[model samples]
Target: MIRKLYVIITTSAALGNALSLTNQTKFKRSPVGGIVTVRAGYAQTPFPEWLTEFTGLTEWPGIDPPYIPMDFIDFSKVPDYKSYPQGVCGVNPRESCSFDCDKCVEPDDVYTCSKLSQTFDDGPSPATEKLLESLDHPTTFFNLGINIVNFPDTYKKILDAGHLVGTHTWSHPFMPSLTNEQIVAQLEWSIWAMNATGNHYPKWFRPPYGAIDNRVRAISRMFGLQAVLWDHDTMDWQLIAEDSNLRTEEQVYHDVQLWKRGKRGLILEHDGSEKTVNVGINVSKLIGDDQLTVAQCVGGIDYIHQYAQK
Candidate 1:
């Protein structure tokens, strides 16, 4: 009887310790006010291809999965505004239109900037400070609203270091799947959160997962924000957090090299992973001395609005 009781107690203690360890390692809630949970280790995706499919839902060339569920906004419901009278139609008038208009002109979807722009996404994490310290030059940080709220100090540090801060959205949802109102809400909430942190509202916004379209760009302009896309994707986000065989450090370098080829523009890296941070520390070697901010690369448009003015 004593042996049986001892076994029960021992089992209970083991289970309790196991649960404690799981809780400790699974998720670490941010100290500030937000739902950003930093996990201890990489959460590997089961089928890596699923991530590609999930992000590319809008542009899936093949037939989508049966009963693919999505909730898109009826853009027709949004009222339209005529182009400003002073707007320049285009150089030839028959091919394209100039974007320098008062009205919500189509966002200039910049692929390659004339100069190299170092940009990181999904950040303002604890790893961010390390990244900033390692870099000899400033880089643009496209921060999530949740992370900015949870780690305002980190966001401020990025700005204090003279790095540009851009919105990466509140919850990091695929923008194309959201309603026009939902999309604007994401940007507005992020801008407000950053402003609340005593930083200027970010004028540039990067759509999560690189999923965006004309409608998304139009709505972004409604909030006086511009959509910034990447010319080179380092795939650093997948280096350690994915189940694919391409999750090695070598793969990251290879991907960056392949994307660079002989072009200079906005290069995408993430500051959310330690592995990525390491990559960022050495990124300058690949891109050379042309590191620039988004605004600088995009012709020095004002990409930050002071909160006090708003």
Candidate 2:
């Protein structure tokens, strides 16, 4: 499968800790929250194609004791994930574990909940415009920074419609394969783009392909993002029906209907394409107004933006 920005959170795995300073930028000190002190890691000139206007700096102090990386990361970049070595996934305990791989570790990354919930991923897409139009209540959309840039007007419309927005990374790359620094670049850049575009700082972070682990989780936590996974997956990305999760239109509708109220839980849907968008509309209707946004379903946090999430 192409896995074009698939859903859910997975175990985080890393190739190595060695950061290549070949093209790294200069930095200086900047303190945050009085408790944590960090410096900015500026993006290299002629930055990565996915670079946003917040190209000033991407900073996260190395994972050291008593020094937590600040959540207010205004930096940006999409490090080439393929350039890094593919670490030994769930295969090696010493190495990282990828959600895409078997034997992977699992802990955080909200996959289930008591109340029913709905969340869309890899969007602000062309088709998502329709999805937004169909929403009756506050919904949560995990948007891609690239899509936000491509569909600036739609991105703004999402905010205007009162739907919650979260970061799905700058350019969707498999998280487990990226280094800690590279992971920081992908996440910070995406966060900066959303903040710059909508004046919104999303607290929810859904790793591409459900890929996350201890290292990935730690990095995301520093930036004040909660990684989300899913218990129910409609697999709306699968065009043809091979199985229930990978079913087509009618099957997907059947799949949605299968989830009885109070029984069904947090599901992974997409607005990445027109087909998915059409299904999303029906999914919402089928799930009904009782369905809560991820923020509400996973309630505890007061507001959507950065605050204290318990």
Candidate 3:
């Protein structure tokens, strides 16, 4: 292994300005989107004695070598879609909503106090990594719709990152459109592929296109997975990359406005597409700026299961 050396320069020290001088070196940029590399030089003499004598930053005992990766999305480079995801007409996600318990009934089936758990679908791609990194790794869980048979590394990365990997129907087919056995196969194959990563059993299932019926639900339940459906969908996937004219940001903002008006369960989002990531980022910032608290549903799945029992 090549040993690495690090030098720190405090912001207020005599030699503080000198540290910026060393950043002159430039490196290659990633051929793929939103990633860059940098070059660095280290001397065996320990960062020139003159620099260390004046700047405590150079002498800090606890200073360690940089290990953080330099991969990130430049959202600016990501142009607005020529087309945008189809906006929902008539219905707003916010407002009163009803919860269905397969068995018992609650006195008040609909309420506005509930919180929504947001989960990204159809990902494990570079876009997924970028979005997750942007969020600062909040406790928000992901229902990764991984087609692991193709991208094994992505499947491994999703599990390694501690996100929930779920079935997206192996080939991204609609669940309701398939026969019962096919649905079971889709669920089973996803689990099998996911398990190969490290014996992780998925506890969630997101039907493609949010198409789930009783049979789909039953198949999911049989696999010990809860059927996940999005309560708020901005239709980010509908955007066309080549269009020069399209959905307005106001329309996206309106979707969020709708979300704020309703009771929550799952906020449907897509992780595989840039348009989706962009919208998610916008909503996150809006929620933060407005001082709205996004609920951390630590026991989201449990709550759903328990609610079902009641």
The candidate maximizing TM-score is 2
Candidate 2 minimal-lDDT segment of 10 residues:
25-34
Residue 1 local lDDT, model 1: 13
How high is the CA lDDT of each candidate model? 0.58, 0.59, 0.42
Name the runs in model 3 displaced over 4 angstroms. Answer: 1-113, 137-146, 241-246, 261-265, 289-310
Tens digits of per-residue lDDT for model 2, 1-310: 2122323331111212222332111100110011111112322112323332234334322222122144453224322223222333443343344444442434545666665667888877667778888888887888876566556677878888988888887766666666666777777767756755676677888877666755676678778788777766665655422223423477656655666544647777877777777877887887777766667776745234642222
Q: Write the per-residue lDDT of candidate 1 for residues 157-275, one digit (tens) a residue.
A: 78778888888887676555555566666776666567667447678888765555455666666667777776566656544542334346665566556546655667777787666
Give per-residue CA lDDT, model 3, range 187-276, as digits (tens): 654554455443456565666655443444544665666654444555454332233233445665666666666544445556665666
Error of 2 at 124 (Å): 0.7
Each prediction's TM-score against the native? 0.65, 0.67, 0.53
* Best of the two (1, 3) by TM-score: 1
Candidates ranked, most accurate by lDDT first: 2, 1, 3
Alpha-carbon shift of residue 229 in model 1 (angstroms): 0.4
